[model samples]
Target: MRALHPLDFLFLSLEKRQQPMHVGGLFLFQIPKDAAKTFIQDLVADIRLSKSIPVPPFNNKLNGLFWDNDPEFDLEHHFRHIALPHPGRIRELLTYISQEHSSLLDRAKPLWTCHLIEGIEGNRFAMYFKIHHSMIDGVAGMRLLEKSFSQDPQHQGITAPWCVANKRTKRLTDPEAPISKFKKFTNTLQSQLKATPTVLAELGCALKDKKNHHPDYVSSFQAPSSILNQRVSASRRFAAQSFELARLRSIAQHFNVTINDVVLAICSGALREYLLSQNALPKKPMIAMVPTSVRQDDSDVSNRITMILANLGTHLADPLARLSTIRRSVINAKQRFQRMSSDQILSYSACVYSPAGFNIVSGLMPKRQAFNLVISNLPGPKESLYWNGARLDAIYPASIVLDGQALNITMTSYAGKLEVGLTACRNAVPKMQNLLGHLEDEIVCFEQLMTTCNQDSINTMQHTQPS
Candidate 1:
């Protein structure tokens, strides 16, 4: 058995019944024409027989000092096939997933499950696959998802994530190694000692930038508490919607902003409207904890992220202004991030996410004033993917929410559409479904801003023309 990473262990040790720490994905597929009624059954059989399981993350379970796993795992315990209740619309599918997402994964077994859900409207079926956050991050999870799919639609021998076979016979990392506090302390001390120069250099740069009075530093804890900062419940409500990727690309191209900046602006506008309806708008721009992927191409299934605080510009009424501010803030943050090494990134990220663990250890919850919420963006396959023979329609990412952080917005751009999944505490974020509508409204408003600004510029050009 291998030892779980300290960061991953933090997720396990701090998990409460009320706060399930996991990330999930919902994939909707169009059932291929001429498929047999027993197609799903056949697919299930294939998965159960596939025999290869990924290690370090997928097959691990708590075993006192470290993680342990069964050499021959029971596949049936991890996979379930469910039929939607009668009149199985998309709404029913989401309701089923929301409930399941709230419940903790069974620790007695593997920390993952796949539900092959049928009975949805149209010639379609959906998969709600969930793995504990300790097992994977969103980026690695996305890559893992490709295991079940095939580039060739007609490829008959595809293996699902659970049964995906490991081809190589080489030994993986030694998970049975002893872990000690003294060793941990020494390792940390060494890393810190090495990072000291980097820290001093960063501080000097900050001081130098302060002398220059840079306008883009977004410090944390500057946000006002709203209804979102209240205590969360054990219940979860998930909402999924898709927007045309071209629309976002068009806006980003027109504004010369990154797609992430556009996403932040959209969220800023949506939260602004959502909170306003409850008469809970904060006078100051809200602070958002945005997790940036720091993983290299060859990184393993661990979470390598840098958490950056972003000014969502909620106080601003104008969409353009919010977009501009988000763009500038993100650009500045990225520049600063690029200056740091991997060790520094981990140090900064640990400092950023440490409070939740501390609060749990203290038998307290996070305060609403700590931060507003989480917003993440993960990129996905550009071309269409097929599972067995069914064409993949959409892939919506379902993410985690903490005690004081009531809501999460995770968007994945799959194929030509951007699928957004909003996960929130059912009690804390009432009518969280309305945020989807607000997001669409903001997109329209931004389009109008582009139109109006273009017209105004044209008018100025005409007025300044020489006779």
Candidate 2:
């Protein structure tokens, strides 16, 4: 059995009926033209009878404080094929996802499942792959997911995520020798010791900056309570939409910011409008815990992510003003992270979040808010990808929401488009789907504002020029 990391164990320990600690993606694909009706059936058969054993993480089941390989790993239990109800629309498919995502993964088996769903209005089928948070973080998951497909449209054979060879050796499943265990212990000890100074320095700086009330200093726990911070129920509502990557890139170029900065600004505007509609907008700016992957190796084993807090600037009414505030907060956080090694960043994040994790797991302060929510942007396949000759359409990430944090916004860039996914407690966030419209509205607002700014600049230059 492999020992579980403290961060991995937190995911398992925090699992509850209301909050199932898992993350997944919704992948849509267009079936090959003039394909027979048995396309989906054939694909399912091929996957089920592929005779491939599940790889690491997929085959790893939860043991006491370690992960043990399930000798009786069942492929059928982890893979399912379903057809949408009559009239087969995206809404029905999303409803199925929202329902399935609410339930907890069975601990007795490998903590993962892949559902091959068909019956959409178009000639499209979707695969929903979900795995427990303990097994993998978003970055590793995205890499593994991308590996399941081929970039060539004519590539044959179905490569299920479980069938993708991760190149892990047998030692991963075998018992560790005593000397190996000792070496691992010593290595872990040394890493933690080395990271101590960095953690302490960061804490000192954070304290000094907080005392001075620095504009860019965002406290880990400095989020205001609002409707989004309310206790969430088990029921979830998922909504996803895609926007042209070029649209956001144009805005970033005009504003001298990054695509991620533009994304956060768009989310900020949408969230601001959402709060106002509910008449529950907080007076102070809301905070978002943006997760950053620190994985240094290609071997996908366990979670390797650290988070930085960003001020959403939801309190600001002006879109440009909100964008500026968010950009400053994000830039400061990035600079701080740049100064730390991966181990140091992980250690620092662990230290800062340990108390809040305890409170969440113990339910001591049910109403306590730790940042408003999570906004994760994961990189996806840049070029168009295909699976068994089907063209991949979009990849939407569905993430977790805890008791006080009822909403999560996760997006990924794929095929020249930015696919945005929103997961929220159905009850806590009334009409959560409305955020999609709001997101579109924010995109248009940015484009118009940039155009106006450019035109004004051109007019000013023309007037200043001598006749």
Candidate 3:
């Protein structure tokens, strides 16, 4: 039996009746008129073939003090099909999926679940998949998609990604097998002996660099307690909103910031407004927990996860200055990460950002609190992707909001659009929908500023032009 990694074990240990720790997404697809069944069948076949998929090395749990191994792999136990009631609308479908995602995954099985949802309105289909945060992170999940799908639409008859029959070999009882067993034992010993130095070096370097490492602005410690900070119930509520990528790009270009910067700025502004409306704004700037991938190599599917405690300059009234401050904070945080080893960065992040409350309740800690809230931005495919013939309409990622931090905001950029999914405890974020409106308003406000700046420049050029 493989053991769970310390980080993965942490996720498992933190899960309680009220808090089910898993991250997932709700993807909407428009079924092709001619071949919906064929496409879905092919997709299912692919999933079937991809059974017994290996968890990433970093995500695997330590079996003991000495070794780490993959979690048990189970396919039928993880993937399921659910038929929505007839005349199902988006609201009904989302409500169902949200409730499903809120509960804990069965620990007896592998740490992931995929629900193939059908019978939704208007030739559309939805797929809801959730994996324990310990099993696969946001970046790793996207990489899995890349492996399962093709860039070409005509790609067909590909074997399922994980269907491995007869994964286990029959044991032989011959006396000669003892020699082979001894050799295997020797090889394992040799491998561990080689790995020990590297592991020790990483541990020493991580401890030395602990103070200097940070993940992102939002992942920091200064985040104050808001309505979103509370005890969460097992029940989850999900809400999603989509914005055109071009519009955000235009705003970012005008301000000379990145698309991610603009997205975060808009979220900051919206949160600021929302808190003010409730008369519950924090006196100091609130912090956000942001996860950034440290995987720099193309061949690696899993990346190291680190967080930066971003100061979401929500206290700043001027949108432009707030955005600029956020930008600087992010840039500095990223620069600090660039200087450290990936192992050091991940270790530092786990120490600083792991939930203290859960650790205490689980009897693993005495007392402490980590950072508040999680805001993640995951890059997705730029070109339109099809599953079978069904065109993927939108992808919304629903992340886990832990007990103390009842709100999780995750965004995925797909096919030139940003789809933001907000998952929160129903009681903690009663005004969740209002946040959506506030986000839209902030985006428009930025767009208007850009328009005014452009107009001013054009008029100035006209006045200075020679006849």
Q: Report the number of the highest-lDDT candidate.
A: 2
| lDDT, each prediction | 0.78, 0.86, 0.68
TM-score of each: 0.89, 0.94, 0.77
At residue 244, give the lDDT of candidate 2: 96
In Å, residue 288's CA in model 1 sits off its true spot by 1.1
lDDT of 1 by residue, 264-355 (tens): 99999999999999899989888887877777764446566667778888999978777766666676767777888877767655654476
lDDT of 2 by residue, 4-81 (tens): 887898899899999999999999999999678899998988898887777787888987777878999989789999
Name the regions of candidate 1 deviating beyond 4 angstroms: 53-56, 165-192, 203-215, 352-368, 454-467
Q: CA lDDT of 107 in candidate 1?
A: 83
The best candidate in terms of TM-score: 2
Candidate 2 is scored at a TM of: 0.94
Give the alpha carbon lDDT tens digit for every residue of 165-188 in model 3.
121111111123234445656764
Clashing pairs in 1: 1-175, 2-175
lDDT for position 87 in model 1: 88
